[model samples]
Target chain A: MTFEKWMRESLDRVETALEHFLPGTDIAPAKLHDAMRYAALGGGKRVRPLLCHAAGELTGASAHAVETASAALEMIHVYSLVHDDMPAMDDDALRRGKPTVHVQYDEATALLVGDALQSQAFIALTTAGNGLNDAQQAALVRELALASGSIGMAGGQAIDLESVGRKLSRPELETMHRKKTGALLRASVRMGALAGATPDAAALKALDDYSAAVGLAFQVVDDILDVIADSATLGKTAGKDAKDDKPTYVSIIGLDASRELAAQLSRDAHAALEPFGARAQRLAELADLVVNRVH
Target chain B: MTFEKWMRESLDRVETALEHFLPGTDIAPAKLHDAMRYAALGGGKRVRPLLCHAAGELTGASAHAVETASAALEMIHVYSLVHDDMPAMDDDALRRGKPTVHVQYDEATALLVGDALQSQAFIALTTAGNGLNDAQQAALVRELALASGSIGMAGGQAIDLESVGRKLSRPELETMHRKKTGALLRASVRMGALAGATPDAAALKALDDYSAAVGLAFQVVDDILDVIADSATLGKTAGKDAKDDKPTYVSIIGLDASRELAAQLSRDAHAALEPFGARAQRLAELADLVVNRVH
Candidate 1:
């Protein structure tokens, strides 16, 4: 399939899978369920799931396990966004071109929604045994937990909150983004690869390198878009970093230098995939998509 | 061993195990780490861990696996309390006789702390294979997720929130409490039972009965205490449930009937344990403690 066709199909699959895994609104606690579905089902680039499928294909992993794991990753991502937008955190009023969960629901419901979504993600992940034995399932859960836990996304968020209104050096800024966004992206690649019957260590290492590079590149692009794109295009507030007094690549290293950094990371990502040769074409295409997207 | 000595020692063991499992203050993003430690290590009854340990002992489960699983359950419990005590939720200022997490730290920190604690819990539980094989570990994760997810504790809390300032029938109140408190308590017992090398279906069912009864008994006693106890004894804001117009067993069925219900549940808990005979001596004592504790 063409890369565009492949990407479109993967996004559709992930959206459908997420809908299947999420509790129905008709169930009890309909309000919280509605809020969770509202936050998770909103249209956004299913970038993590796309990365997962690309890596899974290279490793000859079962498509079913990869899809389930991808949905699981998206749930964690959605939960983070829901919690991050709460009044106690970023206090944002909007997300994905609509009202944030806390704004649409009460702050208390938003909190529970985040909690429940995170719980459901773990539940979804345990079903990855289609091509995997029990050990692989445990490994997948452990890796996702590591990526989502204190030293990963949550810790990075803490650093972001602490650094607001303060000048941070380029290295410090990269460190924050690496944890906040990069960790889950990296896990997405690794998790899909893990479902394969045999995951070659060298190939896994190469994929790790590719994931790290793409993760950083994605953040660099996000920083760029926050500066150049309007909210209508970005689906979130434009220039939110500056308004929140949060440091970003554009603020710390200049937009020109930031673009150069993204290009360099993209090149690194491409180089890391040489181990897979033709098998990694989709991943290379994905790297291009991340670095080149306007929004 | 005397039940008192066993109870005291298990509490001590769990406290130390939790300390070992929690991230040290030296970790980067020390503030979030510190807040997690503060919320988790701060003293409480350690009832869930005690329940987990008692259940784990029945089938010759590994001590290491039991301790790790116990810590994981406690982490989830602590995370729930941290989030539930936030200004947006219960708006409580005190817990365990001290300032709540959101009060001791900023709201953002409290939010991150809860998020991190939950992530760490999943990570901790995956270590169940120290005695359990990979399959058992997977089962443990699935069970805990079911207990913690939207249809469980979070769902129950949603019901509680909606029922505030409004009357709920006895059955409605029971359903809410079953999800809120009973689910986790039952999960505590179920997970520990699962740790055993050979868990028979009949024994598991009986334990489930025992867990359900004790779970409701715990909450019924809690509701009774809320009405009659003082804050100094409860280590929380006693009478706050009625003050907030929240429905409870006492509120729905009256205080005297609530006490009778607790006693009946305790008897049922003991009867369910007849299958284990003398092996469930500790659980029997735990049932007595739950129904009889002053606070």
Candidate 2:
């Protein structure tokens, strides 16, 4: 299948798997469930889960195993988006072309929805029962925790808030993105590989290198698109970073250099997957997709 | 040792275990860690950990098996407190005779502190090396997730918020409390048993019964204290529930009957442990303490 086709298929499987785990929407306090579904199942690239599935495929893991990891990663992503859009954070009124949780519901409901989604991510992992052993499950949970906690996304968010309107070095920006964005992306690939129960140290290391490269490349492309695209095409406020006075790679390195850097990182990401031969094609395609996408 | 003395000793062990797991306050973004420490280590009854230890003792589980579960439960309790004190929630300015998290810091910091603490609680469970097999660890994570998630503490909080100033029946009050307060308390005992690998079907059923009875009795006593105690004695805003027009067991059952019900439930809790003989003395004593304490 083509890269886009494979991604669509993988995301479909993930959505189905997640639907099975989510509480039925018919329960009391139906609005909370509605808010959760609105935030989680709404549109996105499904990039994190796609990376997981591709990494797992490269490592010879089964489709089901990769799908479970993908579902878990997506849940974490959804949770972060819900909280990041809250009034205390970015306070954005929209996400993925739709009203954000707080705008669609009240702020209190939005907060609780975020809290529920975060807890539900771990619930999905622990209950995945997709042939992963307990050790694999525990490892996945641990990796995701580190990716989501203060030292990772939360800490990165604090730094981003602190750095608003302030000048930052390239190294400082990279550090912030690495924690805020790269940690979970790296964990996605690692989780997929771990779920296969191969436990190959060298293979895991290579995947980490590949994930780091693509993760940064993904953000660079996002920065480029924020400048080059519009809301109609990007499905959200495109110039939001500039409007918020947040620094971006395109702003720091110049658009031409940023584009060059993205291409270089994509090549590096592809190179890291070469050891897996044809099984790694999806990962290579994903790397290319990360740097080449307009939105 | 008497139950009170045993609880004090067990709580000390739990504190030491928590300190070892938590990052030192000197970590980057020192305020986050400091906030965590300030909220987590502040004085409380340590009732949840005591339940964990008592359950393990009843099941012939060693102290080592229960220590991590104890700490994890306490972390969840601390996280809930942090969030509950947020401006959008109870809007409480104080807790346990000290300024609440938002009052001490800012609303944003308090929100993130709660977020970090919740994430840290699961991190503790995942990384906890208590000799539990992979399945057991997965089960423990799952149990804790359910107890703390929308269907448990978060859900309970939502319902509690909605039910304020509204008359709720005895069963409705019980259901709300079961999820809000009882779920975690019951999970504490169940987790301790699971950590010990002693959660056989019969013992699990017995513990569930014991947990349910004691959980309600605990709430009953809390209600009584709200009416009879002052803020200086309770360390929180006593009578605030009535001040806010929140429903309670005392409101539904009357204070005299509520006390009678608490004593009866405590007896039932103690009786549930008869099968374990003197090994469950700590748990029985805890039931008494729950209903008899001033705070």
Candidate 3:
């Protein structure tokens, strides 16, 4: 299939799966469920789900397994964003061209929404008939928890909060982004691969390498976009990182070098999938998309 | 063993397991880790863990399995408390006779701490060497997720938030407490039973009955203590429920009826354990303790 067709189909699958997995708004505590659906349903690029599906193709995972894994991955991503936009965190008002959960619902509802979403992510994974065996289900749950917990996304966020108005070395910034975003991105690939057949050590390593490169490339492009894109284009506030005095690649190493780094990382991601040959076509395409997408 | 000695030993076991399962404070984003530790350690009755251990006895589960499950359950309980005590929620400054997480660290750190602790709860279940098979592990994860998610603890919390200053019927109050706190308490018994040998349907039903009664009794006693105890004795602010105009058994049914309800629930809990004979000794004691404890 063409890349555009594949991306569209994958997004459709993820959206449908998320709808099925999430509690209905008519459920009790309807307001919290409403906010959760609002935050998770229509938003952002769904890049993590795309990566999960793409990586699953190489590992011969069933479509059902990949679909379920991707939905769970996306839920975690969306929950993080909901929490990040809260007043206690980034204090943002806009996300995905709409008011953030905290602004749309009250802060208390938003907190419950984020908390519930995180729990739902695990529920999605452990729900029976997801095409994963018991071991795979347990492994995926562990992978997600570790990737999003103190040593990963949340820890990275804590670092970001502490780094405001302070200078961070390039290495420090990279480390933060690796934990903040790269951890979950890498887990998407790993989980997809694990969903069907277990990948051998070399295969796992290759996929990890591809994910690490693409993940970093994705962040670099985000930094570049923050400087060049408008709020309308980005679907959220633009240039806020620099305005907040938070260090970014463009701020620390200049815009030109950051773009070059993104290009290099994209190339690295493609090279890492070389062993898989034509079977990795989708993964290669996704790497390019991460690097070259306008927003 | 005497109930006191058993309770003491179980508390020690849970504390050590939690210490091992939680990330070290020296880890990156040290402040968040510190806050997580502060919220999770050194306080509360550890009632959920005690219930887990007691239930595990009836099913012949390994000590290691029960211990790990208890830690995960306690982590979930503690995270809920951390989030519940936030300014946006209860606006409480004290917990466990010390400053709450948001007060001890910053609001951002406390939020991250709660998020990380939730993740860590799942990690504790899926971690290797936890004496559970993959199927058992997956089952436990599902139990925790379902009990804590939108339709469970978080959902109950949302209802509580919306019901402030409103009159709720007795059944409405019962339903709220069942979800907010009862779900996890029941999960504690179920998970402990599953962690060892899968209980037969009859045994599962009996355990559920026992847990349900005790869980309600626990909440009723909490309301009683809120009215009668001081902050020094309760390790938290007293009478805040009535002061905040939140519905409670004491406010709705009056103190005499509430105490009678708790006593009846305690009797029901003991009756549910008759099927297990002497095997349910700890569970019976726990039921009495839940209904009768002063603080």
Candidate 4:
């Protein structure tokens, strides 16, 4: 299949799996469940889950395990976005081309929604009936928790907020990206591998290396797009990062150099998958797609 | 031993165990570790952990398993308190007789601290040396996630916030309390049993019944203390719940009726423990302590 077709298929599978896993109670507080669905189903590329599936496939992991892991990762991504768009955070009015959760609902609702999503991610991983033994399931839960919490996404966000308007060196920027984005991405691969129970030490290390390069490349491309893409195309304010004076790869390394770095990182990411041979084509394509996409 | 003496001894053991579990880590941005420890060690009654220990003992679960389960439960409790104290949540300036986390640090720091505490809780459980198989570990993680997330404590808080100033029926109050305070308390017992690898369905149900009754009784006493205790003695703002116009057992039912209800629930809790015979004295004492405490 073409890359776009493959991506869409994978995302559709993820969404269906996620929806299936949600709490299906007929309780009076239907609104909470509604809010969760709204935030999760709101359109965006299922990059994290796709990455999980791709990495799993490359390592001979089962599709069912990959789907569950992908759904969990996507839930975390959705929760973060909902929280990030709150008035106290980015205060963005739009996300994924529509009103953000807080704008669509009240701040309290949005906050609760985010909290629920965060918790639900773990619940999904814990409850997934993929025939995983307790130890492997516990490992997946640990990976998700570490990836989504402080010293990971939350820590990275704190640094990002603190570093706003300040110039950061390459090492500092990389550190921020590693926590904010790389941690979850790396966990996605690790979770998929764990779910499949195929993540031997060497495979795990290679996936981590692949995840780090792709994660950084993902951020660099994002920064480059903020400069090159328009608000209409990006679905949110494009140049808001620059307007807020947040440091970016394009700012530190110039647009051309940033592009070069992203390309090099993409190549590194693909090379990290060398052991998987032909099974890694999709992941390689995903790396290329990360750097080359417009939004 | 008298209830107070037993509690004091149990608390001491829990504190010592906590310190041993949370050995100093060298993860940089050392503040990450500091924030985590600050929140975790910044004292509370350790009621949840004690419950886990008591339940574990009743089930003949290992002390090591009990300690791990207790530590994880305490971490979740601490994380909830930290997040709930944020300006956007309860806006509290004091907790456990000390400056609330956000007040001592910055809001961002407190947020990250809470996030880290939560992540560390699951990490602790997953990495626990309890010798349980993977399935048991997964069950523990799942239980914690359910108790802490939406449809649990966070959801309870949201509902409580919305219900403030509004009169609620008895069932409504029960539902709120079940989610807000009871879920984790029940989970504490459940986790203890799971950690013990004692999968006796009947005993689990009995403990659940015991936990539910004791959990409500605990809230009743808390509500009563809000009315009768002073801030200094309670180590928190006294009568804040009533001041906020929040519904409570004492508020909805007269004080006399509330006390009667608490007594009845305490009796029910003890009756539920009858199934475990003499092995459950600690848990029975805990239920008594819940209702009899002055603060």
Highest-scoring model, DockQ: 3
lDDT of 2 by residue, A95-170 (tens): 8899888898877787788788778888888885665678878888888988888788777777777788999899
Candidate 2 chain B has its poorest 10 consecutive residues by lDDT at B128-137
Q: Rank the candidates by TM-score, best first.
A: 3, 1, 2, 4
Alpha-carbon shift of residue B274 in model 1 (angstroms): 0.7
lDDT of 3 by residue, A146-250 (tens): 999999999999999999999999999999999999999999999999987899999999999998999899999999999999999999999999899989999
Global lDDT of each candidate: 0.88, 0.83, 0.93, 0.82
lDDT of 3 by residue, B1-295 (tens): 8999999999999999999898887888778887888889888999999999998998899999999999999999999998999999999999989999888888988888889999999999999999889999999999999999988999999999999999999999999999999999999999989998898999999999998999999999999999999999999999899899999999999999999999999999999999999999999999988988999
Q: Judged by lDDT relative to the true structure, which candidate is superior, 3 or 4?
A: 3
Model 1 residue A199 CA deviation (Å) reads: 1.6
C-alpha positional error of residue A90 in candidate 1 after TM-score superposition, expressed in Å: 0.9
Q: B1-295 in candidate 2: lDDT tens per residue?
A: 7665787789899898778666677775567777778888847888899898888877666676678778878888888898888877788887888998889977767777777777777788788566556776788888888898888888888778789889999998998999899999999899988887566788888899999999999999999999999998988888899999989988888999998999899889988888878777777888888988999
Candidate 4 lDDT, tens digit per residue, B228-268?
99988887888788888889888899799999999999999
User: In candidate 1, how many Å is residue A60 off?
Assistant: 1.1
Over 4 Å off, model 3: none
Candidate topping TM-score: 3
Candidate 3 has what TM-score?
Answer: 0.99
Selected candidate, larger DockQ, 1 vs 4: 1
Interface RMSD of predicted model 2: 1.2
Write model 4 residue lDDT over A9-122, tens digit each, in one string. Answer: 888889888887666546535677777788888478788998888877766677777777888889888888887887667778988898898888777677777777777877
User: 3 or 4: which has the higher DockQ?
Assistant: 3
DockQ of 2: 0.66
Better of 2 and 3 by DockQ: 3
